[model samples]
Target: MQVKIEKLDHFGRGITYVNQKICFVAKALPNEIVKIKVTKETKKYIEAEIEEWVTISSYRIPEVCPYAKICGGCDLEHLEYKKENEWKREKVKELLAKFSQIEKVEVKEIKYLSPYHYRNKVTLHGAKNRVGYYQPKSKNLVPIDTCLLLNQKINELLPKMKRLARENKVQEIMIRTSNDEKESLIKISGDKPKSLIDMKDITGIFFQEEQLQGKEEIISTIGKYQYYLSIESFFQVNQELTEMLYEEVLNEVKKVKPKKVLDLYCGTGTIGIYISSEAEEVIGIDSCSSSIKNANHNKKLNQVKNIQFINNKVENVIDQFQQDTDLIIVDPPRKGLDKKTLRHIIRIAPKYLIYISCDPVTLARDLKELKETYQTKIVTPFNMFPRTYHVECVSVLVHN
Candidate 1:
């Protein structure tokens, strides 16, 4: 059936009505007319694939990557980068008004840098002789030699890594590079490849529970702070934008002048440490032990004296810091805060709350609940994952 795409969804899929039900067409753009075949259907929505394009959007651009259509790593490669940034900001505003009931939202212009070769880490899966990213929503592997979204160092290492994956019969491989591009680490799920142990630029090679070569971590410098990242440590993918994101948080911390800061889902304690000088004391909590270990190492690496890292879930330890926490910053996973955690945060009701979110839908939903005890407004969008639907936001809320 032929349909004109009304707009793009949050996932970068085009939306139109089919049989009075919303249909999502993959790879279709706004104002584009396409012939679609229904791939799946349900009571709420329909999924379709574009069989033919009758009309094309002017905003669409030539994809720089050959595997853009098949690779699941990026979504908006067909859209112009300028338009992509605007759409991201509008999506954040739309979600906030729709889900959070914040109609007069003032979302700052989306911040971004170069759209290509920004990723510091990449994970590829191997099947038989093929090694590459999996197709979206499926386990099918698409053979890839290079990804435009990865750092140049990672793209250069792809050939060797692919060969190693094929020869060693490894099921998965994760490569991480430092921001300076001076250090690199590889983690594999199968046997340790002897060939990779002495690879140039490789500082570490981890196989399962053991380190095959070099040190256990690599150091990355973001802004003025340095962090040591282990194989299992969590760090932002975009190095430049991460510094900007943290700076945004630091600006808010400066305004609040929080005496005691509580950071939830702190990961490697980047945000807490970034704002430590402004606060009298800072406590960061995360359930990932490896992350906490890295966080403590980073604490000493930066010589930060006013911060402490705890290896525990925020929901479990939030109450302990309730009384003295002047500000609470949460950088939650894509699922956002659970009801239990939200309830506890509401009970604690710190003077200031800053939420850094990767998913706008979940962020808006949580902001709605947070509006009960906090004045929610002023969200700033960061193009953390350009060429993809993901957008990071920093929302500052003052206690009511």
Candidate 2:
């Protein structure tokens, strides 16, 4: 069936109407006319693949990765980088208007860095002597030797890592590279591979609960601060944009000049410590014990005296700091904020609320709840993950 792509969905799939039903076509761009073969059909929508292109979009570009079509890593590889950023900003605006009831929201221009080689970490699945990501939403693995989004150091070690995976029957391998791209850490689900010890760039190798080689953690330097990251610590994957995102947060904090700041879901205390000088006191909270351990170490490493790390869930300990904190910064996971946490935040009602969210859908939902007590006029989107559908946003809410 010939279809003219109307617009792109939140997941970067092109959308068109088929028999008045929404049809989604992968790799099809807006204003492009393509003949598609319907792969699946349901009552609500249709899924299709392009069979032939009648008109190609000017925004489409040749994919840089050889396995772009097969590997599910980079979905927007065919779209121009400039258009990709624009679509992300629009996505955030669209979500806010649809879900948050904020019709006239101002979204600042997206902040981005190099479109490629920005990811500081990658997790590859291994099965039957092959290592790569699963195909889209399927369990079938697409074998790949290199991914364009990975740091150069991790890409260089892929061959040996592939061999190690095949030899040791490892099911999963996660490699993290420091911000400087000089140090790397490898974590595998199988037994410790002794050969990984000799790799010069690999500063740490972890298997299960044991550290098989080198140090227990790797250091990532961002601006003037150096963060010690463990295998289990939850740090942002994009190194360059992380600094930019945190700098945005720091700027917002400086404007507030908060007396006491609460950093919820504060992994490794990066943001709290980054803006420590501007606040009289800062408290960081997270559920992960290893991340809290690293957060304390980072606090001392940076010689930050105003911030304290708490190894507990935000909902469990947020009430204790309600009376003292004037500002709250929450960096929630993809699922967004929990009800209990949101309730606690509303009760606390800080003077300023800074939300750093990776998923726009959930961010909009949470913002709707926050709109009851706070006023938010603008949200800033950051292209933290380029060549992919994911976008990060930083929104500030002020108490009415």
Candidate 3:
């Protein structure tokens, strides 16, 4: 059936009405009329795939990816970068009002550095010696020769890595390059370890069988600070904006002038370490042991004395939070804070709270809970992943 696209949703799907029922059409842009085949249906809405475009929007451009609709790695690449940024910030605003009853939230303009060839990392899934991402919402593999989202260096390594992966039995291959492009790390997960690949661009080539054991440690630098990344350590996917985001954190924390600070969900202690010197003391807590290990290594590598790293679930160790800790910076995973933990943290009522979130919906939900005891101060969105629906945001809350 043919429908007129109304607007884009948070996930970049075009919203329209068919038979007076809500419909979501993939690969359909706003202000365009398109014919779609119903793919899935529910009482709330029906999902569809665009079969033909009756009228394309003026903003629509040729997609760089041939397997875009099926690969599912990127959802918003079809939309123009300007429109994507506008919609992403608006999505955050809309979710805040709908889920959290927050209105007119002042979200800063979305910051986007590069729209293409910006990603510094790529993870390819391997099955039966073929490599690519799984088909959308399915386990089926889709082979690809190139991806416009990955860094040029990663793109250059794709064909060679594919050949190497085909020769070995593996589950997933992760390739990462440092922000400076002077170093790269390739980690292949499989049933058995194999000979490492020696390429000029790659600094560390490690195989993960039962555990992560590698030759050279993966080190990266952001501004004045340097970070050590292990095979399992979590780091920001976008390198350039990481520096920008950290600069934002530094600016905000410097204003608070925290004597004692707590960095909750501090993966690899990047944020804590970045602002450690500004504060008299900094404590970083994360659930991942590998990340905490790297965080401490980073602390020692940088020879900073004011910061400490702990490997434990934040909720389990949150009671140890010092009452005098003036500021708490939280960079949690997508699920956001659990109910019990959110309540506990809010009850503590730190003088200032900084939240770093990749998922806006969860962030809005947590903000709603925090609003009762804290006043929403600042919210800024960063384009961590361009050409994708994913967006990163930093929000600050002050005690009421």
| Candidate of highest lDDT | 2
- Comparing 2 and 3 on lDDT, the stronger one: 2
Residue 253, model 2: lDDT of: 93
Q: Write the per-residue lDDT of candidate 1 for residues 113-143, one digit (tens) a residue.
A: 9899899999998888668999987999998
Q: Would you give me the overall lDDT of model 2?
A: 0.90
Candidate rank order under TM-score: 2, 1, 3
TM-score of each predicted structure versus truth: 0.96, 0.98, 0.95
Off by over 4 Å in 1: 191-196
Clashes of 1: 0
Query: Candidate 1 vs. truth: CA RMSD?
Result: 1.5
Give the lowest summed-lDDT range of ten residues in model 2. Answer: 190-199
RMSD of 3: 1.8
Task: Report, for every candidate in turn, its global Cα lDDT versus the true structure.
Answer: 0.89, 0.90, 0.85
In TM-score terms, candidate 2 sits at 0.98
Q: Per-residue lDDT tens digits of candidate 2, residues 1-400?
A: 8999999999999999999999999999999999999999998999999999999999999998999878867879999999999999999999999999865678999999999889899988888867888987887998888888888888998997877877787778889989999888888886556465465778888887778888888899988999999988998999898999999999999999999999999999999999999999999999999999999999999999999989998878876754567999999899999998888888888889999999999999999988878888569999999999999999989898
Candidate 3 residue pairs that clash? none
